[model samples]
Target: MNTLLFCIQNETDAMTALVEVLGQEQTALTQAPSLPLMEEINAVMQRKNQLIASISQLGHTRKNELTRLGFKHPETSMPEWLQDQAQVECWAKLMKLTRKAKELNRVNGLLITKHLIRNQSTLQVLYQNHGSTSTPSLYGANGQSNTQRSTVRGFIAI
Candidate 1:
């Protein structure tokens, strides 16, 4: 019982740390790219990895405890092993925190994707000639056709 409580606390702390780090990462992603910010991103990434590993370890500990307490197939879930209201509350809180962390991570991923696409577009514009005959086209989010070149208003003489 005590072990389960401790595991829950550890998992929650790791999850909270993950949420905070991901928020910091999102901020860093939006800021102007700099050496110090890059270093901070790297550091935050390392911290995120450590927190994930710690949470995983805590999960394993809880599973072991549940299994020892005669809960069948503890790997499946924790509800089967929840013996009291306190355990139920702990499990609920853990689930909530994990959900929040996942959402933040997803938002951060989108931000990174936007940055990557912007950089790629900038490089393409820099390396390619603007007056080139070939025009690249893609669809926008609204399903509208988007061309790299501007449309000519008047017909040109042959």
Candidate 2:
């Protein structure tokens, strides 16, 4: 009983705090974006924080309600802010960026193949001049003895 009361108090306090913060954020978002873009950036950050807090509080409340007589992980429904198209678009863009990076990496591997083919004759001549008998048949920049290369891996990749 005592623990329940404590949790109730905490839950009420957190709900009130989140509501206040969200109200302030809504007001701020409604106001004009400040000059220089930095202010808008900061406001966006603040709003994000507020949204997180609100979602956390709502989750906690829902969890408390559904919790067994003891332990709780706390369940939560979706937050209102997430219903916005901009939020969905942001998530989509992040996913797209990951895909683009993968495509770029694939292209880099193909370019490395081309580079190995183009440099094979020169590498063979250099190996002969140095009297090194072991110059592995190079294919796709991979069989080359990387011991002579720098400690960095894929150093040229952005």
Candidate 3:
């Protein structure tokens, strides 16, 4: 609870810092050719796609800004440290478009993974439970011996 409160306070303080960073980054992008900008955008996008794909392959829909940008999630549960979110805000200062780029690689990665899963019937096979069954023992559930008492091998008409 304290951590959550801290995050809220920190965000309020950082909001102005974020806006200033964006302003500076936009100025830089305006003066620069798009090739490098394009590349950065592409990188962020790739990471986004990768993060999504990773989660999807895990059969889940969880992603953090850090994960989208190739950073690992710090925990196994909800509200995972908010590291990715912070990372995105940081990168946001560098490029508004990079923020968008983070979503691209993720898209590409997922598309590729989806195709592979489809072609191999992997979706059907992924959830398939396959294994050899053990032969049933000649004993009852209560540990009583199951005697092979046979009256006749053939059925008699009553």
Candidate 4:
């Protein structure tokens, strides 16, 4: 029981850290994309991954402890096995933290999706303009007009 409580508390702490990192990710996603911001987001993601792994390990340890204590199905029997008030409270706190982390992660995923959509839209527009006859051809690496070697013209010939 003592070990279970300790494991639960550790899981909760890791979840708290995860939520914090997710918040940072959310903030970074909301900002305009830049080289430095992208670097920061990458760092936040790395930390988030580490926290998630720690939380998963702690959860497994807690479940194993419950099994050792004679709970047939640790997940469903955890509440019942938590006879002590402190144990119950710790479990509840861990549950609450888990919920928070999940919500933050969901929101972060949505933000990332939004960014991808925006980027795709921009790329589509660029492609359309590049293929348009009225649009001027861009200069090639050798400082010559790319009109003669246009991909749209080459595709049409093929």
Best by lDDT: 4
Off by over 4 Å in 3: 1-5, 13-17, 41-158
Q: List TM-scores for all candidates, in order.
A: 0.75, 0.30, 0.21, 0.82
lDDT of 1: 0.80
lDDT of 1 by residue, 1-158 (tens): 38877788788888888889888998999899889998999999999999888889888898887788777888776766677888788878888999999999998999889989998887576435445555543456777754454433342212
Off by over 4 Å in 4: 130-158
| Ranking 3 against 4 by TM-score, winner | 4
| lDDT for 134 (candidate 3) | 43
Q: Give per-residue CA lDDT, model 3, range 123-143, as digits (tens).
A: 334223322144334466888
Total clashes for model 3:
13
Instruction: For each of the candidates, give the backbone clash count.
Output: 0, 0, 13, 0
Question: How far off is model 1, as Cα RMSD?
Answer: 9.5
Tens digits of lDDT, candidate 2, 1-158: 34433444454454444444444444444445456444754674576466556546744664565465433443332232234565455434434544543454455456546656756865665454333478643333775443443222334211
lDDT value, residue 88 of candidate 1: 87
Model 4 weakest 10-residue run by lDDT: 149-158
TM value for model 4: 0.82
> Candidate 4 on 109-137: residue-level lDDT in tens?
99999999999876565556365656444
Clashes of 4: 0
